[model samples]
Target: MDSTYDLMEVLNHIDPSELNYQDWINVGMALQHEGYSVDVWDRWSMNDRRYHAGDCEKKWRGFHGAGTPVTGGTIVQYARDQGWTPPYDPGTALDWNDTISTEGVVVDKNWVEGREVTEPRQWDPAKELIKYLETLFEAGENVGYVVKSWKKDEKYLPADKGAYGRTAGQLIELLTQCNGDIGGVLGDYDPEGGAWIRFNPMDGKGAKNDNVTDFKYALVESDSMEIEKQHAIIRELELPVACLVHSGGKSLHAIVRVDAVDYPEYRKRVDYLYEICKKNGLAIDTQNRNPSRLSRMPGVMRGGQKQFIVDTNIGKETWTEWKEWIESINDDLPDPESLDDVWNNLPDLAPILIDGILRQGHKMLIAGPSKAGKSFLQIEMCIAIAEGKKWLNWACSQGKVMYVNLELDRASCLHRFKDVYQALGWEPKNLKNIEIWNLRGKSRPMDKLAPMLIRRAAKKNYIAIIIDPIYKVITGDENSADQMSNFCNQFDKVCTELGVAVIYCHHHSKGSQGGKKSMDRASGSGVFARDPDALIDLIELDTTEELMKQQENKAVCDACRQYLDAHFKWEDDLSQDDLCSSFQMLNYCKEKLDKWQMEALERNIEAAKAKIKSMTAWRIEGTLREFSKFDPVNLWFDYPLHTLDQSGVLGDIQPDAEQAPWQRGSAKNKKNAKNRKIDRKTALEEAIEGSNFGEKPSVNEVAEYLGVSERTVRDRVKEHGGYTIEDGLIQKSDEKQDTGKPD
Candidate 1:
């Protein structure tokens, strides 16, 4: 089993909550060292969505400062302090040792004392013994050993059981103490059988994983291979083997430090080695291909004889070379298509989500000043979208709408909702497709809140998300491009990944509206305006005319009421019918026109006057006018109703003058009008400079080339005054013109 697997299994079984304080602290230390941060606990708590245990920040304060060391014991202590209990045995909690054979068969050494009185075989350590041992230790491979004994039989000891070594110092000490045969796995040591891995061209150890064994070297093993044969093969392959070792048995192992690709590719190289073995009639031990497989440690005795170092030809190579070698072996691997394939596979875009206002899977921004009815306008659109109705003049693509109001408390949000609902006369049930999240104080940044938002959108099938007051979740310097870009990227992920349209409300920069485009007025970095699919600005309309009209109407109603009160005794006990009769009498007594008298014009006029006066009392009451989405002339929407008649569909209100000075007429016109003066001047200059007719082209030809009218070209020509057109060509008067020369 993999060491990581063993660790995880032990941790999974151990109930942190059940551990004693000290044990929990120890576990925390271990986890911290393993790359899990204290913040992870807080993040995990937030995953459930029902509760927030935000105390983790306080608890882990100052824990990650520089020079702070974390170990298994300290982790356990921290876990205990945090109320986590250890589920595994404390003694072996951090153990990563593999089990090794400790038993050896008993054998008699008797008759040898008298029979072989000859000289006992002498053995001595090599001069490079220490250097060779240091190399293996530095390589971090698991070293195995056969314990020396006075008896003939010996046992192989495993490094994982503390019998061999887990560290360089430990290995040095073991070798010095035992002075016995040393053997180990050529690959890096893990508690598991071996690690399935990949190599990073830049940094091999940088790609460390908690699950797999990390290696700095790769190993290839072959059997029926003598030391000479292994050397020959290494030389033939031009391999960068750090060393080759002769195992006690018939197999020979080649150890190459992994400097290029990871273990997976290294495994392929091992397979290549096997193929070479087959072609050369050299047998290979497939079992030793396992990265964790044990091999003979250099400078160690084999079967009571001094083990020889077969060859040592370590060399330096660039990451580029290793990468090429790794890739070269992958010729047999399947190749997949690239990102261009996706570009080639796309279909044309369909109609926008809400005509020109919004599009599916895109982002929009609704910006305005505070308390400028930005939310009101957004809510109107939300309701319209949910009902599949027209918002002003733009047709809404009906879908589920989610309004997330992070800047408003629940009560305030509901108050606004109630006003809109009452004005629209929509019942609560009619708004079933609209969901509101009044997250005033409970909101996270866009990046942090994406998961929850995605979940809700998926669960409720929301097609659009209205984030009122987008700055509430900005969580960074709004003016900083980098910070804003980070926030925008997260928001875009939500929009594109979930295929939901987003309309986020933002504020206009203070005093930024003068001479600037409506979209440019949005606060923060220009990215706020540039990144959105559509930019809409809501501005408070100047209602001076409406206020004046209301006052004038009030005066008329007061005068009419006073006249009826004084003449007809319009006091207590006066009925509506009586008031109407009195008004008719007053009107009937007016000087009648002779021409209209024959047609009973006086009676009709008196009845009309009476009807007007009768409605005066009720007409002064305020009512919200119906808003329209398509009224480009009047971008401002919804005002109080009045009795005064006007030309507009909704009372006297007209669309405000172009909110964006450059945006006029249809979308095409606006696009064409963008930098229109500058673009035209530049185009005209270029056209004049490129003309080769010894003069400029005719106004008609220039107009056709530029997609402009002849009149426009003529006006430009006159304004410039440097050139004149005669017949069908233009001539510059300063010289004889181009002369039609190739030069």
Candidate 2:
């Protein structure tokens, strides 16, 4: 066969670590072109690259020189074809034959002692966990592992539990290998969602029993909140102000905790106030920072180790109690309020607008349907946000973007990110602003995920955080509406509480069916759509016109119009005429459908009366008389029925009893009626009942008597709740069954 140039190129570019089957074929083809013969290459790797033919190691040969190709010896050649000579010495062929003969014996031995022989140990999960503990220890970081496999909210590791467990920690470490530094607790800990993470922070602090009562705030980078603007808003709202720099989050979080202890209250009260700031172009940080966890940026010191040079409020009195302080401060301020507020109120892209949004952050919602480009969009977003570019030339919010993907195994995820970074023409996957959350996710349910995600988002100070598919972290059965709603609500709560505008990637549900809107089409409920401040959906208008107009009656874009646009960005490579035809089809079909629906509605009322009448002869006549009175195609403006079917509701469906009395067929199904007979059915059942002699029959006797399969006899026996159909004897369903006859 002629060698392929493309194959050669592929072979040249092959990485041994990930050599695919096609690569092997290319290599084999190349080797063949290079004069190798008699054997095929398979099972390739650095440790075990084969130099033999299929399942016949008897004639296996080794490469004598780096430049020389290996060949299968004469024993295999003789077995395949009689006329063959060894390229090497005759002694080599003889040795090959001997080894070939012995190979069978080895295989035989293995088979004979398969169960009894010592076998190689499989992977021990317990040992895997121990090794991970060593990694932390080697890094001089102290941590602990706790198994809360039952419920998520339960404590991770009891405070008294030691530094780390060998087994459980290894599992966490293995999970880390699957995810990354966002290493999380292992097991199905949560019926809700999240994971438990173990890592001793630089401050040597661990879990504490402090209730975060007043503020349901999330930690972000120092730049998350536009401190100047938010402070001004606090003054305007006459609410409290708090900006704290701690070990908890990436940004120096400014907690605006009011009387709102829960998310709903926060949304109504605090979220409203925050939106006002955002509306006038105020930006806020929304990443997570937790003192109990390790810092995302390794060297970004906290706990007053390093001081800010500019000293905006370097050593200012920290306001732990923002409510009282803000109430006091806002009561009396200078003439035009504050310096920043005065500048912001008179805004036309003013310095105050810049000042309001100076705190940079990125929050993303990486969404797509199954096989619909979720990860592609995520990596693209990461590259763009990382590179500070617009998404497909659309304007984008600024900040380093944090990409947390739970769907991928760690190695694959990193590899994909590498490709994305390269595709974006980036030499390095790491940018100052790009953070990928690969760690701290549990394949099974875990408690650590939710808090861990928020914390990671804050720690990175990512202006935008993109969680792909959203199902990975909040993975309940997203199919259930309530589960879907709760998940949405929880995520919304987390995002809102954290002060991040999270772009949560979600799957758009299946095609519009039965006039369900996009919001209704979501796998979950209105809560999934309601939780997000804004939801952007990729429109999948049916390529075929017959499909698009299928949703003509109720507006497909209704519930979402108030929040998001029903934007259709055509993705077809088809010509303009095709596009026009498609559009026209949608419009035409919709019109046709409207007319059909109106006609159907009127016709259905009469048809229903006819059906009710048909159930009874007189009602059928009455329905026919009413229907006959109307003109066939004329408008039925004065038709009586306005509702679809009141019978479906609690309302009764009354009709002429003489014409529509409940049919005997509907009273009880025939098969069930016979089954309800209980003691008697067919002649066979009666015969079985009378034939009982307090003795069982053999399989052969029963098989002979029934003239059926032994399996059928066994089944019959089993039908009467008996096991071990000895000699194929059967048991009848009737309790009094008896087949009395000597074999």
285-357 per-residue lDDT for model 1 (tens digits): 5555654444455454545544445556543353235435544554344578677878878776634678756
Q: Pick the candidate with the highest lDDT.
A: 1
For 1-743, candidate 2 gives per-residue lDDT tens digits of: 32222222223333332222333344544444455453433333232332234522222243234464322321132222222222333323332112111110111111122111111144333333343333223343434433232332332222232233333334445555653322243433322222233332121343431212223332222232333433333333332332222222222233333344544554455444443333322333322233233121111222322211111122113323433443444343345556676665774431110111211222223332454444665566666656655443233454566666668877887787676666555465346767776643543232235554554455455555666656655646766667766565545444544655456666656653224433443455555655544434332211222222322211222211211222333334335443335344344334434665535443543454343332210000001111122111111101211112211221121221212334324433644654644432342343333344545556555555557665755555555452333223434334333346331
lDDT assessment of candidate 1: 0.53
- Per-prediction CA RMSD (Å): 24.5, 32.6
Q: Which stretches in model 1 have alpha-carbon errors above 4 Å?
A: 1-351, 541-547, 550-743
Listed per model in order, the count of residue pairs whose N, CA or C atoms clash below 3 Å is 41, 62
Query: Which segments of model 2 are wrong by more than 4 Å?
Result: 1-367, 424-430, 439-448, 475-486, 492-498, 511-516, 541-743
Per TM-score, the best of the predicted structures is 1
Please give the TM-score that candidate 1 achieves against the real structure.
Answer: 0.41
* lDDT against true structure, model 2: 0.37
What TM-score would every model get versus the actual structure?
Answer: 0.41, 0.26
